[model samples]
Target: MTDAAAGARTTAPILLGVVPFGLVAGVTAVEAGMSPVQAVAMSVVVFAGASQLAAIELVGDTAPVAVIVATALVINLRFVMYSASIAPYLRRLGAPARWVSAYVLTDQAYAVSLAEFRETAPGERSRLWYYLGSALSLWVTWQVATAVGAVAGAAVPAGLSLEFAVPLTFLALLVPAVEDRHTAAVAAVSGVVGVGAAVLPFDLGIVTAGAVGVAVGVALDLRTGAFPVTGDGEPMGDGGRERETDDAAGERGGERR
Candidate 1:
């Protein structure tokens, strides 16, 4: 099967959770007095469900614009980590493609792609198609589900409590990543911090917990000479196939001249 097809197939099962999360986002938007158009726009534009929901919460609280912005930023800070992790496979694209990729860089996309990246060491062309396929699958689902939720609004029913899908979905992605003591330590630290700081204003606790978790991971890495993935994502060693390809191209140029 084509790489894109593989990516789409890999992402298919996750949509069960995504559907409800998107629906909740849409319903939450309308319940907060957003126009269907505005809610849809945000889904298409921001495309980050956690940030969108957090922003909605702040808006409902009549919080200041600064707090809302800060909350969104805090929630999305994970993307910095995501970008750094995936840059090796994706950095070869042109500026425009990079821009498009950035927009579609959801947690689901990043998690799944990184796992695939480590295993396949797929070439750049394959990586692009695969990532786009996985990311677009999610992008389409979020938009449609949100639109439906916006239109359905209160009719979505309170008993479903669709909000639970968000955490459960994240847990699904996270479980595979914690394969060792270091990762387990990081998860433990982040969990404790997140629960303890749950009452913090503007959802700063989320970032706070993440930051602590990352720091602990880093310290452990540095101390144990685990400086990098230790195997997975060995960005230099794995994706360096592209670097080798580049050198080969330059040598061919020299011989041709």
Candidate 2:
């Protein structure tokens, strides 16, 4: 399958997990007194469900605009770590493509794409296409689901417990993504720190937990050489092989001939 096609296929199953979350976000926005247009616009523009939900809850409580913005930004801080982790693979893309990729980056996209990128032989991977395919699928699904929720606001029953789907989605991705002891430690530390810090003001706990988790993970990786480096200073894949370039493959073929 083409890279994009593969990404879409890989992403399809996860999309089901996000549907209820998207609906909750949309329904919550409307319940917070936002008009349907405003609710759907937030889905289209902000596109981060967790932050959107936080913002909507704050709005419902009549929080100040500055507080809402700050809270949303703080809650979304994990994107920084996600960006740093994926930068190595996407650095070769042009500026426009990179910008689009950055905009579409999400937990699902990052989890799926990073897993695929780490497993595939580098020479055979099309990182951008895979990323775009996964992200765009999410974008479209979120928009549609949010729109449905907005229109069906208050009509959908409250006992559905749709909000639970959000965490479940992350849990589904988290299991397979934690490939080694270092990552498992990172997850454990982050979850513990996040819970302990949950009482912090302005939802800063999430940010604190993410930063600590990343730091712990990186320190362990460096100490253990979990991330092997190629001779050219590029990081090797999980298999300890440097990604082969097309030219390098051609050279090997010629040599064999």
In order of appearance, the predictions have TM-scores of: 0.86, 0.90
What lDDT does candidate 2 reach at residue 257? 100
State in Å the error of residue 50, model 2. Answer: 0.7
Determine which window of 10 residues in candidate 1 has minimal summed lDDT: 227-236
lDDT of 1 by residue, 1-257 (tens): 38888888899988889999999999999999899999999888789999999998778788899988888998898888778778877766899889888989999999889888876767777898899889999999999999999999999989998989999998998899888898899999999999999999767788788789888988997888654343333354454556567778999999999
lDDT of 1 at 154: 94
Which has the greatest TM-score? 2
lDDT of 1: 0.86
For candidate 1, list the clashing residue pairs, or say none.
none
Q: lDDT of all predictions, in order shown?
A: 0.86, 0.86
Local error of candidate 2 at 214, Å? 0.7
- What range of 10 consecutive residues in model 2 has the weakest lDDT sum? 238-247
Q: After superposition, how far is residue 166 of candidate 1 from its true place, in Å?
A: 1.1
